[model samples]
Target chain A: MDVDRLHRRRRRWKERLMTVLIYLSVLVALLPLFSILIYVAIKGIGALNWDFFVRLPGPVGDPHAGMANAIVGTLELLLVAAAVGLPIGILAGIYLAEFGGHGLFSNSVRFLADVLSGVPSIVIGIFAYALMVLPVKHFSGWSGGVALGIMMIPVVTRTTEELIRMVPRSLREAGLALGVPRWRVTVSIVLRTAAGGLTTGAMLALARVAGETAPLLFTAFGNRYWHRSLNEPVAALTLQIYQYAISAFEDWQRQAWGAAFVLIIMVLILNILARLGTRSKFSTQQE
Target chain B: MSSSATGIPGQGHHPPAGRTGSGGTGEQPGGPLAAGGLQFSSRPRRGLADALFKAVTGAFASLILVLVLLLVLELVRSSWPSLKAFGWRFLVTQTWDPVRQQFGALPFIFGTVVSSLLALILSVPVSLGIAIYLAEMAPHWLRGPVSFLVELLAAIPSVIYGLWGIFVLVPLVRQLEVFLGTYLGFIPLFSGPPYGIGMLAAGIILAIMITPTIAAVSRDVILAVPNSQREASLALGATRWETIRNVVLEYAQSGIIGAIILGLGRALGETMAVTMVIGNRPEISASLFSFATSLTSVIANEFNESGGALHISALVELGLVLFLVTIVLNSLARFLVWQVQQRNGGAARV
Candidate 1:
């Protein structure tokens, strides 16, 4: 009995030690994130102003000038990307989950999609640059959206497929039993049951593309003035931050922090929304 | 936003089908058997409209696949100009002087493989420990928050990581380099110029960046092991640690290795962070503290400024190399996961 007691105590001690190490690991993970956030928030608070939101980025050295153009450009590109990519992504998701099975073509498509998921965003940018920017003789925000749309598709498709697959097959069969066509059963039954998940996935993908800088560096090529043209070079918060942060100027560097803060905040909000979207419906279903 | 809301409502305005369908009679189309012939009859489709809808849906699905194929093809074609010009020598030669239109990728390739391997070597043990803690030892209440924080690390953009590495981690690494040189200078790896931004620093930052991917996937794999194995080990009078060491880790070994490979792939493709911390030196080095340039970092830093035929081709070649590395890593990971699934299936059969 005493030996068992000692063994139990030893196990408890080991467990406790492991728990402490786990917490410490979590703390270490938070260190970089917290440091960056705190630094950005502290430096950026002073620059937060309405003028900063409405004016163009100043010359390479200036910090007081606003990031209006970047702000507008990011939103425009994200909107355009969603417009182009979402329906296609969701539909592909539908096909993969609902229509796809053991067919050779479907398997090939699935393999290609997985490969696309692993390809770096910068390569996607390079491809867009070679295909669109080079041929068009100039950079354009449309191509930026195109690059982002490409990145978003695999992510959206994967999530959408997973969610749609979670819907019961009986529902699909019931729709078909009502003399509804296969397409109708897919559209109305499977997709509707999976709507919450699809939305969450699409939003997460949008959030991801919104923060992308690599593709934009080559595709949209950064704008300083608000031209409101997708054909023209457009300044985005990420690109602005990238270009400014790299320059040998402190004032511009401070503004980069400001932009980082803004981008981080935007990502945070989108994440919260995505979490909420995924969680609320998911929990109800679990119950 | 409103237009999107309107457009999406059209997609979403369907009946609650899945849950309700399950409750319905097995033979009936829907519950309560509105079995009148009129109820069972199909409404005549507005034939052309229905046809158009089907075509549109099919087109949309095909478009994503088409886009993916086009991307791969475009990469191949764009890479060809340089691959053909340089031949296999592109991977061997290290001279990257663009002024003379001479370019090579040996340094970049070396840096990428070395730094990525270093990251994997450094991170795998620490992350495995963390995963074991989370999967086996953590209180249920602490698990979700810890997992969420790890996931949030992934959400932090690579650029933010770059900035933090420059402003915060680099100085710390520089201090540590001085200390390491003081104590370990006899070792060739520690006998370098004490520039903080070197291969070692980049590797360490990458280790930190890739840890979450390793830890998260590993935790999931460990948790998937059946409780029966644990009980069986306990029944043999084994300690908990023994049970975990002999049973849990054994079951999760393949998946854990897969997770590490996934993390390695992320480290390999990491661009902005390595760019900011790697000193941008396009030189091959044997010492860990020497400055170097990774393939992705070189492309990210120099691609825009790289004018002329050879310069551009060289950068594209680096991208191709990174792409191939990631493809192999992902395939390895997928294969491992498949094996784990198969093992679990075979166990069930036994």
Candidate 2:
């Protein structure tokens, strides 16, 4: 009886010890994320000013430099990428949801999309350089846009397909009963129902691509001056931050922090918006 | 009139045929009923429209396959010149002199493998702990917010991690190296000078970057473990910790391995953060504090400024190597995930 009691006591102590270790591990895992966010805010908040959004970057040693051109250039590149990738992604998704019949062709397409999404972004940059920059004899915003577009395709396609598949088959039957063509039923009814989710997916993809610096390092090539044409080299916020962080200039380093702050805020906002969209959709379905 | 009468009964009894015929005459092309199906005189136009839409969407779907093939072909073609010149020496040679135009992949590959494996070793325990906490221990109200925060770490860009690493992580690593070197100085792995920006710093940053991926996936896998297993263990007088350690973890072993493999893929392909903190020197060393360069980092650093054809081709070859490593890792991860799903009766969502 004495030995059994001692064994039970030791077992309880070990269990308590393991439980404490688990909680401590949680704290350790979360510490770096909170520290990084807090540090960036502390260092970056001081550099934000009206001029930071209005004026162009000054020379290397200038203390009042801003990244206005890079901000505009980033938006332009995103717009071009959206225009090129969105249509193809949505249409392909439509094919998968409506016309796909569990055949070898659709299966291969799905597999390829999965594979493409996993490819490293830097490799995609090299691909864009080989395909577009070599042919044109220069790095251009268009090449950067193409690289970003390729990255966006798989995310957009997967999300769109999932959302379209979520639309109830009963709705399609109702449209078909009313004598609507199959394609018409898909476009007018199914797509209309899935628009909100599709938009959320697109926003998430855009947010991801906006912060990509590796692809832009080679494709856009980071011009110092204001760029107006798609065929010309352009600066991007992420690329600018990379350049500033690596340079020896103290002022540039400070600006890099400021750019990092802005980029993080934009990405977080998009993520929050997507979360809200998904929540509302779920609640409505439950109701 | 005749077509309308047939359509009304056909819609009720044979919905599939009725729907097909009503959409267009393409379904009954050259059939005996073609003359009657042609009552809708715009059938030809509708048929053309349907065919056009299918063709367009199918073309777009096939484009993804073409793109993957093109990526592989282009990388091979671009790296051909170097492959022809170096034959097999490129993989074994260690010199990376751009002035002398000698390039080798051994050092970079060594750095990438060592750093990524070190990161996996450091991160797996903490990640598994977080996963278990979220899946089994956390209360209902705490699970949602904590999981969201963990996933938010993943949404943060790699470049932001790079920026944070440069200013915040490098200094702390320098201090840690001093303490380690004092105590473990006799050991070869701790014998080198501490540059602060070296394999150790890169590995730490990679551990942080990949922790969320492993935790999230592992949490899902643990949750997929049937509740009856836990209840049975408890009923048998097993402690909560014992039940989890023996039953839940054993059941989710394959899934946990899959999550680790997925994290490994991310660490190996990581470019920006690793490049920023890794000190970007081409060398194979035993010391964790020695500066090292990875495959992705080398390509990112040199591809643009390379002047000669051979130099550019060599960089492309490095890319090919990274690409092949990641593809193999990802495929293995997918297969393991599929195995987990199969074991779970196809209910595992991730």
Candidate 3:
């Protein structure tokens, strides 16, 4: 009895210690998250002004600098990326959902999408550089957008497949019973049912690509002034932040933080909204 | 919604290629229509439209495969010059001087492996702990916001992490490096001038960047472990921790490993943060404080300003290497996680 009591006491102590360690790990894991947010907010919030959002970046040591062109350029690049990525991804997803049935081809495509998602963004940058920029002999927004588009494809494809697959089989059956064509059933019934999920997925992919810096490094090849066309080098939020952060100028460093602040806010907002969107979706499904 | 339920289309099963290939012609003309076979004799026009739709969608799906093939082809084609110039010497040589055209990938490979492995080591236990906490230990109220916060961490851009790594993480790391160097002077890994922007910084920043991925995947994996496993252990009079260690974790083992491997794949490909804080010098060093470079960083930093054809080729070769390695790692990780999910009869969320 005495020995058992002692053993139990020791085990209790060990368990308590382990529990403490486990809780501490959460803190440790979240430390960087809180640190980045706190540091950026503290450093960046004070630097924000109307010019920071609207006006063009000023020369070195100029406090009147802004990142309007980068902000606009990022939006433009995203549009091009969406135009390129969404259709192919969503259509491929429909293939997997409507026609694919654990067949070898769809399985291979699924595996390829997963692997493609894992390919480093830098490699895609190189791919873009070789495929588009090298042939044109100039870095342009189009190259950057294509790189981002390629990156988005796997994410969007996977999510779109999953969402379309989520639509009840009975719905398709119901559509077919109405003498509708298979394509009409898929588009009108299946696709419509999953549209919300598709939106959320697309938003998530966009949010992810929005923060990507590596792919744009050589592709967009950031310009200092306003960019005019998809054919020309474009300023981007990430590239600008990178340029300023690495510069010797202290003011530029500050502006980098300001730009990062805007970037972070955009990314976080999209992420949160998407998560909420999925949550509501799950709740409805559960109901 | 569970994927397995809806993953199948029309419940035809994995119909063989032959059956599916001639499915349209086999149903043609409704030869001697039986009770249930083809009462309406499906219209040929509708069949054509369906075939066209399938063709279009299948063609688009094949484009993904085509895109990957194109990626491999482009990489190999562009890097052929470097391959011819370097032969096999590129992998073993350490010098990366482009001016003299001496390109060796040894240093970058070393940095990438060392830093990514270091990140895995630093992050796994913490990520597993968070996974266990969120999946099994946290009160319901705490789970929602904590998970959202973790996802928010994942949302922060890597460039911003690089920015943070530069201004915030480096200065703080300098103090740690200085302290470690002063105290652990005998250990080669810790013995060097503390630059605060070397392998150690890269590893730490990578650790921070990959934590969310590992944690989120792990949480999903642990949750996927059936409740019956835990209940059985509890019924056997095991302590909660004991049940977790012996049963829950054991069941979730492959999944957690998959999560870590996935994180590893992410770390290897990470460029912006690693590039900014890794000091960007190609060197193989035992000391964590010494400058180093990684594969992605070298590519990201030098691709644009490449000196000439050979230089660009070398970078593309490095990219090819990265692309292939990540694909292999991802496939392996997904296979492992898929195995666990198969066993537990639950879908693993990525």
Q: Rate the local accuracy (lDDT) of all candidates.
A: 0.75, 0.81, 0.83
Question: Highest lDDT: which candidate?
Answer: 3
- Can you write out model 2's per-residue Cα lDDT over B199-239, one digit (the tens) per residue? 99999999998888788877877876778888999999989
Q: B59-136, model 1: which lDDT tens digit per residue?
A: 777776787677767777777888887888989998988898777888988998899899988888778877777788
* Residue A92 CA displacement from its true place in model 2, Å: 1.7
Pairs that clash in candidate 3: none
Best-fitting candidate, measured by TM-score?
A: 3
Clashing pairs in 1: A223-A234, A223-A235
DockQ of structure 1: 0.34
Better of 1 and 3 by lDDT: 3
Error of 3 at B274 (Å): 0.6
lDDT of 3 by residue, B127-240 (tens): 888988998899999987887777677778889999999999999889999999889979999988998999999999999888888887778778778888889999987888
TM-score of chain B of 3: 0.88
- Stretches of candidate 2 exceeding 4 Å from the true structure: B1-47, B348-350
**1 or 2, which is superior by lDDT?**
2
The alpha-carbon root-mean-square deviation between model 1 and the true structure, to one decimal in Å, is 5.9
Candidate 3, position A119, lDDT: 90
* iRMS of each prediction: 6.6, 9.9, 5.0
Full candidate order by lDDT, most accurate first: 3, 2, 1
lDDT of 1 at A35: 79
